[model samples]
Each structure stands twice: as structure tokens, then as C-alpha cells.
Target: MTTTLAWIDYLIMLIYLAFVLGIGFALKKFMKTSEDFFLSGRSIPAWVAGLAFISANLGAQEVIGMAASGAKYGIATSHFYWLGAIPAMVFVGIFMMPFYYGSRAHSVPEYLRLRFDEKTRGLNAITFAAMTVLSSGISMLAMAKLIVVLHIFDAPFASLGLSSEWIFHASIVLSAVIVLGYVYLGGLTSAIYNEVLQFFLIVAGFLPLVLLGLKNVGGWDGLRHSLPTGFTHAWVGMSQASTNPLGVEVFGLAMGLGFVLSFGYWCTDFLVVQRAMAADSMTSARRTPLIAAIPKMFFPFLVIMPGLIAIALPAVQEAAAQPGKAATATSWPSKGLIPAEAEKDPKTGEMVPKYLRQAGSDEPLLDANGQKQYAYDYNLAIPNMLLHYFPTGMLGLGLTALLASFMSGMAGNITAFNTVGTYDIYKAYINRSGTDRHYIWIGQLATLFGTIVSIAAAYAAAQFNNIMDALQLVFGFVNAPLFATFLLGMFWKRTTGHGAFFGLLSGTAAAAIFQSLTLPAGAGPGIKGGWLANLHTFPSEMAQNFWLAIFAWTTCFLVTIAVSLFTKAREDKDLVGLVYSLTEKPREDHLSWYKRPLALGIVVLIMTAALNLIFY
Candidate 1:
């Protein structure tokens, strides 16, 4: 089960890591102030910013998770990337960037403070900090797990008789330490530069795997033959219920949410936002996200395609035939075999599937159908494929590419953490009169602290049964609420401080309740029996919390709009310089009607719709 690492593979990874560290060291000279450390002194050009933006967002989880989704849902899973993400980026580049950039704010919370109040700003910053730490840590852990599964250090550690568990733990800590060191030294500048390098390397590494995989799978025609009937169809395998949780079931809601949520992340999330915020001017900041959108449209071809191919491989089938190694056949938890089905029930002393076992077991076993079943570890699919399929020199490149993904993502999170901590917390609370040097040091300290906390979070994430599910569940609970509040804040100027605050609270509560109460213990509703049966299994602890948040947000929005009609309005003068102010610009009498962005957005939407229609 062990693969030998070629010298070239080790050399390439070493060189890549060294180059990353070199950039960090080189950027130290630019670290004279907090602004420079956190935003690259606003000197980055549109292209660099664009590349960094895309790279930073494509962490280890993306590579593995998308692949896992592909394995489970087929091409339908690409909706998250293509249908959900691209149009959103287009919207952000054309519309949202103007406001965010014009504000000249260091963090999203800082913008909140200017638009709302101090309490709102502080609350958001802390929440963001907590979520970022947890998300980034889990990402690091996933990347390290991939390395162990790929056997990158297999030969070197063989003499030590280390178990995979030991290797997994060591990899996580080691990867974090390396990332922390470079991020601490260079801040955003180093992170972005390294991201650019990592971006190219990851593509180079991944392209080969895709090509080889397609070839091994007997070409596109053969792949289709091996997969389920609806395998290539974008919407074929998805349950209508799975795609829409709100019961509203409108195509627009699905499409709009896909577009809106994606825009919210690429355009507004601090991790990606920091890239544009680092640009030299409004023009660069605005252009960077648009420029980044081009590659994002193409990512599915690289990231998701491999997962589709993974299921077609002979090895996966062969592995499934063994005593304890089943490939997941469905995305829904209840549809797949459970733990108790793979082992003997303790109470009755009868064999049960591992996934159905009331209590978990350390040992692996086989399902009744004689398939090897690792019910707890679906995320291992992509890494396992790499180990089996990639050749020697190629293996090195692939491993390096995976590591690059981890580095880029970690660097992005660290940059966001440092910027928010320095600008929002340090400036707002401690040492307001601090000198430039003092601020730079504080930024570095914040990054260090953030990295440490993230590492702990990653360890905690390992305990969860389904990493990808947990990640989405967490986002659904947190980001949905934030999205509601921000949406009202930007578009509805009549929204009062109380409205904004309560709206956020309500939206968060609503999402939390839905996520906790609607989702089953080991299964989401769609697969449990039908949607209704599954909904009954929703975790009680989180149900009321999410509902309350959503209620609060909606009530606040309504009340605020009402109050604004009767109350004295805030001076329009204070808001004149913000993003929405562009609408007030005098229309040019001779303005040309190129419609380039509109045309592009239309084309993207059409293409996406056409593909889905044809695929289904």
C-alpha cells in the first residue's frame, strides 16, 4: 500500500517551500507599518491581486471536498463551483467592489462600524475571527490527512513503526508551523506572492492527474459507460429537496441564492476581500475581482472532473470489494450504509453495518454485500486516488500542489485575521496612539495568535464525523445571517441601527434552527425517508437558535424601515462618498453603451442554464 517518493518530487516540494519562505523574508523590508503588513501598502496590481484572490480561496478542502462531492453526486456537484460561484464574481466585480473599495476600510467590520455602530462592528469582528480560525484549522487538518493517505512520508517513517493516526497528527502540526512561519514573516505581501507561485504549481500538478485519469478511465466515452445513467447531467442526481431547503421551491430562489451567496463570499468575505482591499486604487480594486472571475469559471474542469473520474476507476471498484473499504455511492448520509451494518450489534451480538452501529467502533469490517466499508471516512477518496494513480515525478508535483493549496488558504485566513485584529480591535480598544512600528508588531502578533487558535480548531474538526457536511452546516448557520444583515445595510439605507442589529440576530437564529433541527443525526432529510422524515431528526440544540436569529433579522429590517419614515434621517452627506453614491453621478450625455459586463453576465448565465438543461 506504500508508494515510493521520487527524488524530484521531494526536490520540487522543497524548492517551492523555500521560495515561499524566501518571499516572506524578502517582504520583511516592507513591514514598516500595520497597513503595509495587512494590505501590501495598497500597491498590488490588479492581476496579482486577482491571482492571489483565487488562490487564497482554493484551500485543501476545496480540492478534496469538491472531489468527494463529484464522487457522490457526479457532475451535479459542479453547481457549487460554476453555477454558484462565477456569476456571483461577475456581480461583485461590476457592482459591489466599488462600494467596498471606495470606503477605504481595513476590514468588513470597520465598514460596519461606519455604516452602523461600534457594537455591531465588534460583534462581527469577533464572530468572523472565531469562524475563520475554525475553518482554517480544519482546512489544515484535511490537507495533512491527504499527505498521510498519499504516503508522501511513508518510507521515511516506516522504520519508526508509526501508525497512520500518528502520521496524521504530526502532519497537521508540521504543516501549520511552516505556514505560520512564512505568514508571520511576510504578512499579506508574502502570502499573495507565494499564492501566485502555488497557483501555477497546483494547476500544473492537477492537469496531469486529470489527463491521466481520463486516459485510464478509457476516455470520456468509457467514463460515461462506467458511471450511473445521470452521471454527466448537472442536475440529474440531485433531489429537489436537497437543493432547496426553504420549501419556496422557486427556480429563482435556487438560482438567486446560488448567485447571492457566492457573491457574498467572493465579494464580501474578508478572506477574499483583503485581496482587493490591498489594491492601489478604486480602479485596481474593482478590476481585480473581475479578473479573478475568469479562472474561477474554469476551476470545475480541474477540481470537480477528477472526482467524477475517481468513481469510474477500476481500483475504486476493486477496493470496494475488499473486506473494509466501500466507496460512497450517494451524498445523502442515510442513503449510504451505516456503521452498524458493518459490525455486530453489541446488544444483540448480531453483525451490523459500521455506520448503523449505535456506538462507534475502532476496527473496520465489511458490509453484508461483501464490500469493504469505511463509513466514517469519505473525505479520504481524493488522496487515495492520488496515491494509486499518480506516477513518480508526477507524484511529487501533485503532493506539492496539495501543499500549495493549504499554504495559500492558510495565508489568506491569517491575513484577514491580522487585518481585522489590528484595525478593529487594537485601534479601537488598545493603544489608539500607537506608532507605525507598534502597529506592525501588533499585526504580526495577531497573526501568530490566530494561527495557534486555528491549529486547535483543526484538531477539533477531526473529531467530527463528516468534515464537508460540518463545514457547510457551519456556513449555513453563520454566513446566511451575516448576508441578510449586509444585504439590508447596503441596499436599504432606511434600515436603522436597531434594525441592522436585530436583523443579523434573527437571520443567524433562523439558519441555526434550520441546520440543527431540520438535519438528521446521521442523515439530512432528503435521504432519511423523504424530506419530512429527515427533518424530524434535526439536532434540537441548534434549531431554535437559527430560527430566532432569522426572526430577529426580519423583524429588525421591517421595524427599521418603518421607523425611518417617521424619524429624522441621517445626513445624506455622510453616505455620499460610499459605493452606492455612484448612482448619484451625473449621467454623461455622450456615454457609450458597450454593455460588456452585462453581456458577459448574460452569457455566463445562459451557458450555465443551457448546460444544466441539456445535462438533466
Candidate 2:
């Protein structure tokens, strides 16, 4: 699993890094104002913002998690893209962007403050800031681990008389420096441009891998035969929780993922919304997500193919039956094979993972932790596929793409963190009337603070083997409930600040309570929950997350409506642009039918539905 990169690969990555820094430096002169730094001066074109919107999301969650789930759950992973992303992206660009963009607010939390109470905005701001840092850490962990696993920096480190063990730490430091260097200089504008770069790089880097992988696996038809039952199909076997690899029924998938978690992340998550908010006008803001959704509809093939191919390819000439169970480390074709627990080494009297062939075999199969030998490691599907297929020159491009994917996440999260920290938290609470120049200084400082916090968070991400699982769990807790609040506040003017705030608290509590009481079927009681009691068990972690979101959203929705009835409401004049009923609809009569948000939104939905059926 450890592959050393060549000088050519190193050179390609270096060039990409330099260009990344160059873009930041080039944009530095324009970032004098806080608006320019945090919101891109709202001067970006719709097309650029759209690309940045998608690229901002192509971090560890997209590249690593998508591929991991594809390997683990087959084409069902497409649900994360098609079912989870497209509709919400279209909705945000169409329905939500007007409130966010026209409100003249600095951030999402600021928008909340405009529509609701300060307390509600404060809670969201704090939680969102925390989530961004944690998310940034996850991206950092992916990059550092990739460098360590691939031994990408081994040559350079050794030449500098550094111990190989320092690779992980050094890599983390280097990754932080790269992201911080650009983000500190250009802020949101720099991150957005870099995201556009990452988007292109990811497509360019992964397209070859997908083409070569499918070629090796006998194309689509061959891949179907090579995969296990239901692995090639997305919608089939979804009727029953036990019938599919995803371990959830149709209802759970639709409501939990498609509705709750999907809307929670795409519609409300600041990580994505910040991109649209940076658009030049209401039209561009509305178009940002719609444009992103066009390419998003087909991204599954680019990202998910590697995982399917990774699992389908056999170490020997003949393929074997796909096996169940996940490993904590990088696995290549081994996900299709069963692995036993590590055995004790007779000589050292210490437990260590071992590769066995027969009754008398002694092959050293231990990973870096001496515990990741024979089992399936779903996390490395993308990394493994890249190594398996790419040659020297192409390998550098692939590695750069992978690193860029990670940077998109770190940069996006850090940028969002700085804005929220500076405006939502500091401006609102700490320093009520800071000068614009002072706030810009604070934002740059926040960037440094976020990177340092993310470094700590990256270490925390190592506890989870499945990166996507870790990601969804975070969203389920922070986002799922928040969406309920936003839905009611924007659509129902009767929803009071007290109601929204209390409903949010209750919803978060409900998520925590549900998690503590339920456990996935095969998982032991740990962070996967069931600490309080195993009152209910789920088919899988993904299933649990979806249901958790359902409960959270439901609780918040009901509680907010009920509480609003008992609380005082604000004046209609103040609520004009904030609430949907009071707010005038965005006009697109001057534009052609095809250019209208609704028309494009409907088309996107129709196309997404077709994809689900086609892959079913």
C-alpha cells in the first residue's frame, strides 16, 4: 500500500501549489475591505461562483467519503450526490438565495439575526464555527494521512535528516501552511478561485482514473458482473433495510437522506451557502447553485467508479466473492476478502496483524499501527485506485488532484469560520462597532486560529475509519435540526424568536438522546451511540444517521410551531424580506424561460430522477 512518488510527480504537485499561492498573491491587492475578503466583493460571475460552490464541497467528504461509500455500499453511494445534493443545491439557488443575498447580512447567522432573535443567531454561529473547524480538521487529516500512507514526503524528509515518523506531523504542518498562505492573503475570494481550480483538477485527475479503471474492469457491463448483488444498482434492493448493502429502506433513504440531511447540508450549511452569497447579484446568486447542479448530477461516475473498480479487481487472475466488514486502515482489493483479528507473535509476544496463505505461512501483513492487515479498508478506495492505475507523470497529477480535493474542504471551512467568527460572533457580541479595517484584521487572525484548531481536529478524525460516516454524523447533529428552524422562520412569519431558539435546543437534544439510545446492528456501543441504552438497533450507521435527522427535524418542526403559538410575534413591516410569504418573489420575467431559476430547477429535478431510475 506504500508507494513512493517520483520527481516528476513531485514537480507537478509543486507547480500546482505555486499556482495556488500565485492566485492568492495576485488577488491580494483587491482584498483591502472586509467585504472583499469575506464575501468576494460580490463581484464574481455566476459561472465562477457555481464552480466554486461545487469545488468547495469536493473535500474529504466528496473525494474520500464518496469513494469509501461506493466501495462499501456500491452505487447506492450516488444517493449522497443525486439524492442528497442536487435538489438542495437547486433549492438554495432558487428559493433560499434571495433571502440570504438580498438581506444585506454578512453571514447566514447574521441573516438569522435579521429574521429572529440574537440568541438564535448566536447559537447557530457558535455551532457552525465549531463544525467548520472540525470539518477543516477532517480534511487536514485526509491530506496528512495520504502523504504518510503513500510515503509522498519520505524522500524529502530523509534527505533533510528528519525521522520518517515525523512525516505525519510535517505533512500536517505543510498542509496547514499551504491553505493558510492562500486564505490569509486573499480570504474568501482566494478560496473561491482555488475551489474552481480544485473542481477542474479533480475532474481532470479522476477522469483518467475512472476511464482506466472501467477499462480494466471490463467497462460498465463487466463491472456489473464483477460486483456483488445490488452493488451495481442504486435503487434496487432498497425496499427492505436488510435487502441492500446500504442497510436502509426506501422511506428512510427518502426522508432522512433526501429530505432531512440533504436539505440540512446543502440548503442551510454555511460551507456551501457562502459561495452563493458571494455572487455579484441576485440572479447570479440564484444561478450559482443551478449551474453547479448540472455537473453535480453526473459526478458519481467520476468519484464512485474508483471504489467499485478497486473492489472489483482481484489480486489473483480470478475474482472472489465480495466480503463484509470494514478495516481501520488502507485496503486495496481486500474489501472483497474476509480478514480475522490479529494473532499474537510468538517471538515478540505482542499481538500483530498477519497475512496467512496456508497452515504454515509467516507473511508480515501489519499496517503502520500493527492492526490493519487483512480486512477491508473502505477509506482508501480513491488513494488505492490512483496508485493501482496511475504511472509516474499521471501519478503526480492524481496526487495533486487528491490534495486539492482536501484543500477545497480546508479552505472552504476556514474561510467560513473566519467570516462567522469575525462577523457573527465578534461583531455581534465581542466588539459591537469595530471599524472595517479592524474586522479585516480580525478575520485574518481568525484564519490562523481556525487552522490551529483544525490541526487539533484532524487528530480527532483518526478515531473513525469511515470518513463519510464521521462527516454525516457531524451534519446530523448540527445541521439536521437547524434546517427545521430555517424552514419555519423563512416560510412562517408566525415563528417567534423564543420558539425558534427553544425548538433548536430541543431538536439538538432529541438528536443526542436518540443517538445515545440506539445502536447500529453490528456496531458496539461507543461514539456510534447506545451509551444510555440500546432501546433500538439500526441496520447500519448510515441508517441511524438518517433516522436521527428525521427525529431531530420532526421534533424541531413540531416544537417550533407549538411554541410560536404561545410567544409574541414581530411586526409585519420588519419581516418583509425575511419571510417567504411577506417577501416578494424574485422576478425573472426579463430573462428567457430557460434562464429562469424555476425552469432550471425543474429540469434538474427531472434529470436527477432519470439518473436514479437509470442506475436502479
Task: Say which candidate scores most in TM-score.
Answer: 2
RMSD, one per candidate, in order = 6.0, 5.4
- TM for candidate 2 is 0.91
- Summarize candidate 1's per-residue lDDT along 1-616 as a digit string, tens digits: 4466877888988898788888888988877777788888899988899899899888977887777667766776666766667767777666666667777788888888887778888878877877777778878877876666456776657767876557787888777777788888888888888888888988998888888878887887887888876657665424443452222123433433464455556656888888988888766676677677667767876887787776676543322211232434322122221111245567988444455323255454557896554453445455556665777787787888888888788878888888888888889987789888888888889888998888888777777646645555555555655655566667766655666665666556555554444543444443222233234543322222233334434544465566556655456666654536423532323423332434445665566666557655
Listed in order, each prediction's TM-score against the native is 0.82, 0.91
- Per-residue lDDT tens digits for candidate 2, residues 435-493, read 99999999999999999999887776676566646565655676778889999999999
What lDDT does model 2 reach?
Answer: 0.85
